[model samples]
Target: MALGLFWATVSLVVFLLISTADMLGYLKPKNHFDVDGKTVVVTGGSQGMGRALGKLLAQRGANVVIVARDRQKLEAALKYISAAAKDVEKQRFHYISADVTKSEENIRIVEEVTSWNNGNSPDVVWANAGGAYSELFIDTPVELMRSQMDLNYFAAAYLAHATLRSWLRPASTKQTSEAAAAVAPRHFIITSSVVCFVGLAGYSPYAPAKSALRSLADSLRSEVRLYNGYRRANPSKGPAADVEIHCVTPGTIFSPGLDNENKTKPAVTHILEESDPRQTEDEAATAAIKGLERGGYLITTQWLGSLLRAGMLGGVPRNAVFMDTMKAWLTPVIWLFMQPDLEGKVLRWGEKNEVKLPQ
Candidate 1:
């Protein structure tokens, strides 16, 4: 007992020291870019989380541009965002109708927005255009699967690529020096679902696409770091062009999309999703924006979502809070014991219902 107590005391002290060191390292000045007067673009901005995000950004005094395929919806979203804007004259709101799933349309959309802004690259580009459908893998049509990937993955990729290319153009070619000055501290946000990490029944098509975003975000983060390094080495270019890439993994959000999803979502899928607290679109957007402002690379909008993220311990970047890391490391261990029971429930449901599996 005495030996065990001695070791426990030593362990506690060591843990405290490590936690303190990590906290200190993480406390360094974070660059939370100001959105005031910055041009911001959001895809699928006509409705749901996209509209919510647009409203919030406009409220922050950003010049908001909302993109969607539906002209009427785009006009409505513009009005919604304009109403929320801080200064009507300065924080302008505009909408463009474009099919984001098409690569060419994404390019044209960026060009159009730049032209409208007098060749100024947007300071922030949010790829919030995505859709989810839940069905048994066999029941999911090939075309539906393809469309989901196109909308959820390709759309975001095209937008990010186009925006980044525009943002990285030579400073001398910018319409004005002020435009070049606005280029650094750029942000690209992707709205990835919690299903990205925590896959469930009837979500095979949707989960993989969202999971692909994790890889995309990780790769971009590394590339951005390298680009920033080069800029830092070349002092003549002024400050380093810091492009921050963030992937927001929100759990169930109550939006128009969710309403549609609920109509077709399988019972098992709903059961699994309902395990986590559902958030309103506004709440999710608020959490996501706050996470981005705090320099979070992987953002979660709810406690359960955060726990699942931490528990997975994927290669994604974390917030680096000591207790959060500890919870993340420990949660998986706890889940290891809990998951079997959860799996058993799923299996029992499948067996009792004789649910068909895809060959």
Candidate 2:
């Protein structure tokens, strides 16, 4: 009798979850990314996915600022992006040659962008300036780990810190609370990797940094609500607008960064990632943009990404709660069988080879 009752309760819960998710999914916005007439800042915008995003946003009618440390590539990106502008007269494009790894430089980026935007903060900021180094943890140098952390995690954190401080401030007395209420929400997007969810054999140095980015997004997503709640309480005296934090975990891409990582990627490491879906720069950016438009907090570009993310969803915000819950339920069962296969490969690789420690 107890077993039957427990089964009955489980069925009821599943029913309710599905019904709710269906209703919510149907109500989701079609194009919530809404960049038209907004000023956007994209780091790593000189090439690859960043440049594709900049160009796409331009086509959708955004005034874009692309930031990178390379003047030549940025300048080239500016022209490419500028030509794609939906409104030649109204939409503008510029490039900033600044290394985002420096905190002070990030602060200056915000200041310069604010100045360029006629004394207003950018409506969106995309942190895509990061790099990767692959090696067994034992073979990896402590110094390389520091560089990985700086490029992948701290760089994005520095920019985000500067952005939120400039954004989350006391509203100007000149602007009425009702006007602020009508303002659209702002977006902060960070780019992580699929490996962040599941650590691999050869990515000891890179995966943790990307994982940090995911963790930061999750924490900030919840914390930003405090200001938004204050806005709700004191509509006339709160923040300028609602803030949404999103993390985009893109799968492997055919890009220059990937090219660099491949030169050092271990053979067994490549075997571990053989199943990952591959997307071109434009494809990844386009899919990610669509996910953001649909109000996804943790966005993934492909099927494998979604599956990987489902297995690891802790307390993060949900894109489709019921679907995610169902996948989350099934992923562990799948992992039960898959984990051994992966472990066996790692074991065999270790038996056949040894990593030469960097002196």
Candidate 3:
């Protein structure tokens, strides 16, 4: 009798979950990004979204700077941005060659760009330099995981620290009394991976690194707000200020890396295959700019974007409740429970939030 009763309750709960998902339109698609007239810098701008974003920003009348470890790639990116810029004569196009993983190199890049801008720092900095290679946890080497974290998370933190001062500085002192105007000079954009949301067997290294970044963004957002509050209290010497920080998560776009993976990985291996033809570089950039301009907290492609938002905002309601109920309601059958890894198939990335600019 008890066994039949348990089955009845389980079936009822499952039915409710399915019904909820359908009613909420969980599978619907949408686009949410916006960027316009912002002075922007992109790390790892040689190729992929970094290069794509640079061109889009330039076309929108932004002063765009391309930074990468390869001088040739940086030069090439600059050429592309210059060609795409709306008003080539009015826009400022610049490039810097630096390896962001090295702290000193990042510091030098910040200094160089600041000096070149007549000491005024970039308004938006996009830290898009990251790469992930899939490997099993037991097979993964320790150093590889460290390198991933260093490049994806630490490097971004380092660059933000180096540029924070100039980035948050107040408007020009040389301007006439009437011309003096406040400026929100600092805005940071980070390219974090969708792997941050779900876990899989072979995603040990990459997932953790990406997850760490989400935490970093959350912490940084709080710190910036606290600092802004402090400035408001002691306003005598400080300049007017605001800083905005945005973390952009994108779905799999067809890049060289993804292309290579598609060829190597078996087609039947995963339920969610790489996106068809992936988003073109130009398309992804255009989408991203749209997200920034709209001030999106989580910028994403339509399909996967909705899934992530749902997950963050009270996902797994049925599963959470079911497990708890099982433990209490079915204590005798507790041994039958197994932690099932239903890795989410939706591929989405990006989170955006406001932060204070440095003074």
Candidate 4:
């Protein structure tokens, strides 16, 4: 009897393992582009991850347009990117200081970048400037949520629309109509967070905004593909094959802002500071280049692959991840009754678990 019980348990475990591997394989990311010498624009290009991506792309010979509201920071980032490239004469980089939240400003930035590219629109656009604060729902002001929406969702959408509009427009009258009709390669990239998939506890204002962004990206991907297909079927009337959209979800980065967030909190400060295995800005920059070159649809940190794999299998929409987190947090009693052994199993599974951030 004892032998039978042990073998039964082993069989069950083996079955579960096989099922898990199949799911992970299905969810493995597909790589899509090599961005070398491409005309690319990175919003919030002055600091943090945006600056990191810009510098990395420039190093790989991409013509980088660094966009930010602060001119000084833009100039500083340009110097850093140019220096990273090292061969000053070979490097091609530009800067446009503008606030992306406003439609007019977004249009202006697009125009400025296009002008520098000899009236050719940028081939790649990285909308990486959005973020939100973590505060208790009751204590959080309404404006905070509004601000998050404007910065994270609206700005990214506006930039994409403006870029597509400019791309579809003719370049110049000087060139023959046929010569001017040639289309340039294009990509729209946005920096979304893991919070787009799952919400934890304190991200009330930010998580929903990110969730909206995920939906936008998914919808935009379909729209771009459909539009392109329609044009391909009718070459004379359709859009050129040079336009695409990519959404990137990077896991918790050990950024200066994360450092600052940790420092301000009294009890968790030491642990937060110590927890980080800091990657140099240059290293992060390099990673961005690799991800872009591979044409990654949803770029994530090395640490996030498992959770994302699990997420894909559940057939969970991006927003469903956030909702599940809330349910888990609010119904601990329900969880205990439903999966009495899950806690021990979760703990034993791994030490560095991919925890969901509070929404």
Candidate 5:
């Protein structure tokens, strides 16, 4: 008992030291850019969280451009975003109607936006267009699975690739050196879901697609770092466009998409996923933007989402906070001990309910 007490005390002291250091900003990464007056592009900006982000960014003085497939929705979003602009004359909001799932369409949209900004590339691109449908993997058609992947995974990938390519263009282009000097750090944000980390029974089709997005975000983060490093080393040629990639893993959000998803979602899946408190679209957007401002690689809106992010760990980099990392490492052990109870809940739910396929 004495030996155990001694070890506990040592552990507590070590944790305190790490936590204090992290809180003192010794472990945090530098924020390379600010959003003020920057050109920001958001996909799926027709409604929900995308619309919220567009409005918020516009209000903060960003020249916001929103893209969506529905022209009417896009126009409506533009009006909402325009109303939120701090300076109507200086901060312009544009809306483009295009299907993000098509690679060619995404490329075209990026090119047009660049042209509209007078050859200036967007400083931030938020890939927020994705949908989810909860159904058993076996009951889901291949077409549905393919559609989900196309929308959730490939859309973000195509947008990121196109935007990065434009941002990394030769510095001798139309952008003046003065503009380059004031350039905000380029950012690519992908809207991945908490489902990416925790796969429930009915979300098999949707979860894998979100998981693919997480993988894409991870790869893009590493690649962007390397690209920025090379540009920095060869500064004589042009300015370095440092791009930061972030993945947002939001828990349940109160949005139109969620409402539609819940219609088809299974009861057992709801029991598992709906355990966390749901966030409004505006609240989620606010949290996501705050995370980006803090230069976080993995952003979560809720405590449950953050805990899941840390617990899953996988190949993603650790959060800048030392206490957060410690919590993440310890969560898996807690999860192991709680597995029986969790499984029992699922078993009981399964026994009481039946999942029916659509006719």
Candidate 6:
């Protein structure tokens, strides 16, 4: 009887494991996220993950548009992306030099893209332009606080709002119900950070802005559905395509940005950060694209990022309901120790360093 009970428990565990894997997309067919023949716009495309995303989309047969402030880098990136095109002769690639941190510029970017796409909005837009400035909260300059928010949160928000408006504009002539229903879905992707979920010290100037992005994505995902329903209800009026909002939480991406951030990053923050294994921008972009293909709403590019996401997933849409729930349930149990350990490390570092800010 005892042996039967143990075997039964083992079988149940195996079944659960299989179901979790299937639910989390390991066993599912990846039929979604098809970008062939689509137009994609990626901001921050001059460098880092944005550049990688553009190159990958080009490889996937997309007409790629890369946006950045540096015309030279944008031109260089365009050549590299254009080279990866699935159809060199047929596919098109372009770059826009714009400062997305300004709301007006974000709006202009959409207009420019619309013109370039023959009065049609790009099929996909990624708000990937952002920066990180690390400092102790008290030590961070007041001016720097606002600048960080501008670069990290408001830039993405500005682009998202502007592009969404363009994507949702009504057709010049009312579309037939059937035509509206048949329209392809448009995606707006936002880039956030794993630190947004589990913040580290010395990221004072940056983490909250990233956290705001995660929050914004959660709200936008639900909000976009209203338009999806609106189109289904009154197909003739407008919004020819359905809208989907996706956010990616990437762990430390090895890029020029990381190198720049390290110059200002604190020793304690560095110590805390070492737990995450670094990934290059290309690897991060690849992982994020895979998650997007799986239709994950709140996606993470690494195991630790996934764990952090599971812990703080309050009312956000789940990638896989059962898997996310189980992981969510398990996270707090691990955090019981993790929380204290992290706090203790901070306390120890503080005591040893006698941290102080200038008066």
Leading candidate by TM-score = 6
After superposing candidate 3 on the true structure, give the runs of residues whose Cα lies further than 4 Å from its correct spot.
1-38, 168-182, 234-236, 260-277, 313-359
> lDDT of candidate 4?
0.66
Q: Give one digit per residue, the lDDT tens place, for model 4 in 1-359.
A: 99999999997787666556544654334444555667889998888888888777776677888888889888998988778773567658888888899999999988898888887777888888876566545556688778878988889989988987876543333343354245444788877776676543356667787778777877877777666665555555555444676666665566765564443222322332233245555555565555655555555544333244234423323322332343334454544552444344434433655543455
Model 1 stretches astray by more than 4 angstroms: 1-31, 173-184, 235-240, 354-359
Off by over 4 Å in 6: 1-17, 20-26
lDDT of 3: 0.64
Model 4's TM-score against the true structure: 0.71
TM-score of 6: 0.94
lDDT of all the models against the reference? 0.82, 0.89, 0.64, 0.66, 0.83, 0.89
Candidate 2 vs. true structure, TM-score: 0.91
Let me know the TM-score candidate 5 reaches against the reference structure. Answer: 0.89
Model 5 steric clash pairs: none
Model 5 lDDT-worst window of ten: 173-182
Q: Residue 23 CA error for candidate 1 (Å)?
A: 12
TM-score of each: 0.88, 0.91, 0.72, 0.71, 0.89, 0.94
Alpha-carbon error at 163 in model 2, in Å? 0.4
Candidate 4's C-alpha runs over 4 A off are 1-32, 169-184, 260-285, 313-359
Q: For residues 121-190, could you state the per-residue lDDT of candidate 3 as single tens digits?
A: 6667788887766665555578987897888788887887776665545445433322322444367777
Model 4, position 227, has a per-residue lDDT of 66
- The clash number for model 3 is 21
| RMSD (CA, Å), each prediction | 4.0, 3.0, 12.1, 9.0, 3.6, 2.6
- Model 2: runs farther than 4 Å from truth? 1-30, 173-177, 354-359
Clashing pairs in 1: none
| Residues 147-195, model 6: lDDT tens digits | 9999999999999999888877776668788888777789999999988
Candidate 6: residue 82 Cα off by (Å): 1.2
